[model samples]
Target: MIERDHPTLSVGRQCRLLSLSRSSFYYRPAGETELNLDLMRLIDEQLLETPFYGVRQMARHLRNEGHAVNDKRVRRLMRRMGLMPIYQKPNTSKPAKGHKRYPYLLRGLRVERPNQVWCADITYLPMRRGFLYLVAIMDWHTRKVLAWRLSNTMEAEFCVEALTEAIQRFGLPEIMNTDSQKMVVSSRVV
Candidate 1:
C-alpha cells in the first residue's frame, strides 16, 4: 500500500520503491455511469424472467422498452457484468466415457397415447451466480411436463420426487426412459 501522506517518504518515493508507475498510483477508476447502472438493472430483471435471452434478444427487449440500445452495447454490458445466456451445447447426444449404449426400443414402436411412453430429463437452470439442477418428467407423445423439481445439487432426491409426483398424478406409463447418467445416479440413491 502506498501511503500518500507519509511524513518521511513522498508519494513519488514510495511509488518508485514499489516499482509502480506514477500515473497508476494516482489513478482512480470511473465506475458505471448512471444510465449504464439503470440499464444493467433492467437487464438483470429481464434475465431473471428469461435466462436464455442472448445479446440480440436482450437488445431487442431493451429497445422494445423504449431504451436506445444495440446488440453491441448489450454484449459489452453483459460481458462486463459476467452474465451469460444458457443454450444447448453440441455433441449432447454422444454418451460419456465407458457408458453403455442401450437399444432404442421405441424406434420400431409407435407412441400414440400419452401414458404409453414417458421420458425424463435432468437439466440445470442457470442463475446469476450458480445454477440449480432440474428434473422434469414429461409425456413422450403429448410433450406435456407432468412434474418437475429443482435442487441445488445433482442428486437422486429431486429426480425421485419428480418421478413420484408424476406417477401419483398421471399414473405409471408403460415405459419410462431417461438418460443413462440419470439412471445411474437414481439407482444409487433410490
Candidate 2:
C-alpha cells in the first residue's frame, strides 16, 4: 500500500515509482483544515464527555478554555460531526410516503425461541478520512449476529443483501424489529 511505503518517499514519487497516476491515488481531502480538524477533534471528545452541551454552551466552554471559537462555527462543526440533541419521540416512527407500515403487533409479546424475533439496527461509523454505514440483524432469543454488512453509501441495497443472507442461512423470523430509518426499513419491506 502506498501509505505503507518509506516515510521519506513523497506520495507523488511513490505513485510514479508504482506506475500509478497521482490522480489515481484519489482520497478526499480531510473535510476540514488541519486547524479546524484539531478543533473538531476537541469538540468531539468534549461532546462525548458531555453530550448535553448545545452549540452555545459548547462555544462558551471552548472560549473559556481559550479556543476563540464562535457558536456559529461550533454549530456547523457539530453538525458536520453528526452531533445532535437527543429526545424522546411520542408519535409512532415515521415511514416512507408510499410504503406500507405494519402496526407493532409484537409489543408486550414474549420471545423465547430462535426465529421468534429478529432485531436490526443501522449505525454510522465515522473514520478519520471518511465514514461508513453498518447494518446488522440479530436474533433476539440467541443474541447472535445473523448477518451484517457495511457500505460507504447509505443505500438500501446493502440492507437487502444482509437480510437476504440471513434468510438464506437461518430462515425468516416470526417478526423483524427495526427502527423507522428509511433505508433499513424500506429495503426490508420491498
Q: In terms of TM-score, which candidate is strongest?
A: 1
Q: State the lDDT of candidate 1 residue by residue for 34-79, as single tens digits.
A: 9999999999999999998999889999999999998998999999
For candidate 1, the 10 contiguous residues with the lowest summed lDDT are 181-190
Number of the top-ranking candidate, with lDDT as the measure: 1
For model 2, give the 10-residue run with minimal summed lDDT: 181-190
Q: Look at candidate 2 and tell me the lDDT of residue 173.
A: 82
Residues 81-178 of candidate 2 have per-residue lDDT tens digits of: 89974433233234557976657857688989998888888887755345678999999899999999998877789998998999889886878887
List ranges where model 1 is wrong by over 4 Å. Answer: 1-69, 74-101, 181-190
lDDT of 2: 0.79
Each model's lDDT comes to 0.82, 0.79
Error of 1 at 7 (Å): 76
